[model samples]
Target: MTINHRAEAERHLSKASFMTGDGPNATPVNPAAADHYLRMAQVHATLATGQALVADASAYRAALASWRDIVAHFVAWGLSFAENDDEHGTYLRLAQRLDEAGLNIDNDIDKITPEFGKDPRGMWKPPTVRRAEWAAECAATNPPF
Candidate 1:
């Protein structure tokens, strides 16, 4: 969760706790108001969770782009990575996870290849798993041909 959102959630939760006289030093509030505060706290907590998800998604996108660029740079520099190498394995695993998560849409080579000042280039992962996942999803959704 982002700090502000988390703080907001905690603050609302604390207010609800105080209203309910959960703290020994706290005075009690009307039961209905306490319920309202509790609900508000839940809302804030949900917002915090949502913020965390958004942050994670943003980080993933940036990381994906960065990793793509790194791989491209290494290949251009003539850095040969065997299939059993850790670097290659890490990227392959990430590609597989992205495929499973339905985020394998950026597998197109031309779309990802860097143009100097452009975006990243695709890694050398075999897109078979990603392709199969996409195919299964498309079939499951029953999209019009």
Candidate 2:
């Protein structure tokens, strides 16, 4: 008549794991206890991935222009105030993101301040402009025939 505490603990641990749906495709051993935080992680994993990247790569990146516009609108439209030294780093990072996204800023001095500058060059353009530019380039090149 021997008692095994470790075996009993292991059994309980396994039962808890299954009840909480702890692993991928794990069938709930105790369906009554299926509601747990572990499922939140699985649901977020499906939802939080970058779904905005489904289109053509250029268009996907170009679509970031709308985000840039929103930033600019806030920077210009917000309440008037000067910048603080401590918050300069955040503005610097924001400025760098605009530059990294192929947008050139005017009023370069304001970039270091909280306003993130006043002007943005090379902003969004319509697809028709791209088509016309492509047509011009194609005409400039000699025909293969």
Candidate 3:
């Protein structure tokens, strides 16, 4: 996984872990923890897939370092997110890291769909798979490592 993505996941996981522990209100907190674990798993899975697609060691290392920084921020925040809506914050931070690293997330439907123009509807099918495929395609082109 890219470092920034991992960091974001780690941050969420840490907060979730704390919510499962002594976090405020304690009930909804567990639900959030569940969400956190699921999201963490998703991030890890995406990273693994990206790693398999990339062959550049240096790029991979840099991505890993970025994720560590994100996780560190989360560790520093502890249970403070318990009262705030921080879900989108992680995505924003991750985007920032990718931007700083000159990495582009494959969310450009226009770019990805145009290539599939021959297909029915002239667009990619199933938004989730489309996103994943676009990301993998982008990774293949740039090779993050």
Best model number under TM-score: 1
lDDT of 3 by residue, 1-145 (tens): 3365555556666765666545566544567566768787678757865765675776789997786665534422321222232543454455457658775432432233334342323232333444577799999999988
Instruction: Give the number of colliding residue pairs in candidate 1.
Output: 0
Winner on lDDT (2 vs 3) = 3
Q: Give the winner by lDDT.
A: 1
Model 3 global lDDT (CA atoms, 0 to 1): 0.52
Q: List the pairs of residues colliding in candidate 1.
A: none
The per-model lDDT (C-alpha) reads: 0.59, 0.46, 0.52
- Expressed as tens digits, the lDDT of each residue in 64-112 for candidate 1 is 9787666545442221232344655565565556569775534443344
Tell me each candidate's TM-score. Answer: 0.46, 0.25, 0.25
Q: Of models 1 and 3, which has the larger lDDT?
A: 1
Query: For model 2, what is the error of residue 16's alpha carbon versus the real structure, in angstroms, after optimal superposition?
Result: 60
Across 20-136, the per-residue lDDT of candidate 2 in tens digits comes to: 444667654555454332354344444433322433566867777666666655443331121442243354455567778777443433442245442232112223443576688
Q: List the residue pairs that clash in candidate 3.
A: 1-47, 3-63, 3-66, 3-67, 4-66, 4-67, 7-71, 56-145
Question: CA lDDT of 19 in candidate 3?
Answer: 60
Q: Which portions of model 2 show Cα errors greater than 4 Å?
A: 1-62, 75-83, 105-145
Using alpha carbons, what is the TM-score of model 1? 0.46
